[model samples]
Target: MPGFTKHMYLNDLNKIKSDFSNYIKNIIQILSEEYNLDSIMYILEKYYPYECQILNEKYDYYCLKDKKLIPLNKKVRYLMPKPKSIIRGLKITKKILSKTYKDNYALNFDKNLQLENEELLKKEREPKINKIKEKIDKAKLKAQEVEPSFLDELMGLYERKRTTQKDKVYIFKELEKYYCLKVISFF
Candidate 1:
């Protein structure tokens, strides 16, 4: 009921009508083929089993109640039934086809609604995400603009002293005391 509205039902019925039209056109095309009655019967029996059943049962009841061998070609008109039987068959087929389409449409409708909601949420969050990104960028830029502190310079010097000259360990040991005093004074 969520996705199945009156408009949807009407649209589905229109589509089924078009599909039935195409089906009738195909049936006419098949009948127009130069195949024999046996081949025709085979095709009808294979595809339009319900129609064939109606035709056989009705014709037997109406025309061939007593007779055993009812002429296949003449007893029935084009291996199809009268208007009433054809309409009944179409109604049944339409009900089935419409139900199938409605079920499939309902399933897809939920997925589509979820996808739309996800997209909307993404859109709504985009500005906040951009603001956060902008703030982060400004922080990075501010950090870059600020000069290095004495502690950072001292750390750099210590690293260079360790890598460049292992024998200059005594010199760095003396500088370490001065560096610690400077750090304490600054803080």
Candidate 2:
């Protein structure tokens, strides 16, 4: 722990957080479906006490993949000693070096690790880029087909025919008949 005194320890904080995560996972497994935030808090209080935040932040474990923390009929049935022992071990070390504990070291480590993991995930997701591009191209083609320009020209021609054809030569023949009838009545 000397080389990892505090500042130097931060260099590989991500690894430490990963280790802690594994440790938490293992602890949860031992408890089975018998684990609850309240009970876990009690154990932490009885042992390490300082890491009680783990119990208080139940939301952190709400989506836990570990079987131990999973609920069964709203009940937790098993209790184990590994987590208490782990917490106790850390508590002793943390108390001795309270001033130099630098909890932020762990926090910073977790942050960096998460960022690195995200970068890895982003790389894994790189292939989807092509799929998105293909979708965009398809959409553009569909939009162009939705409104063909020739329809507008056809519509204009139909409108002109309807309005002007009404006053065309066919109407003149009817008017001539009306005039002849009017002359016969006058005679």
Point to the candidate with the largest TM-score: 1
Top candidate by lDDT:
1
Give the per-residue lDDT digits (tens) of candidate 1, residues 1-187. Answer: 5545435544644554455444443343333213333443454444445545544554444333224235443343123244334433565334533556446545555545545654664465457556766985775564433233555555466557355565346445544444233432332
**What would the per-residue lDDT of candidate 2 be over residues 19-69, giving only the tens digit for each residue?**
444434333322222334444435334333233444333223322323444
Off by over 4 Å in 1: 1-109, 145-149, 152-187
TM-score of each: 0.22, 0.20
Q: Any residue pairs clashing in model 1, and if so which?
A: none
Assess each prediction's global lDDT (C-alpha) against the native. Answer: 0.45, 0.39
What TM-score would you give candidate 1 relative to the actual structure?
A: 0.22
In Å, residue 117's CA in model 2 sits off its true spot by: 0.8
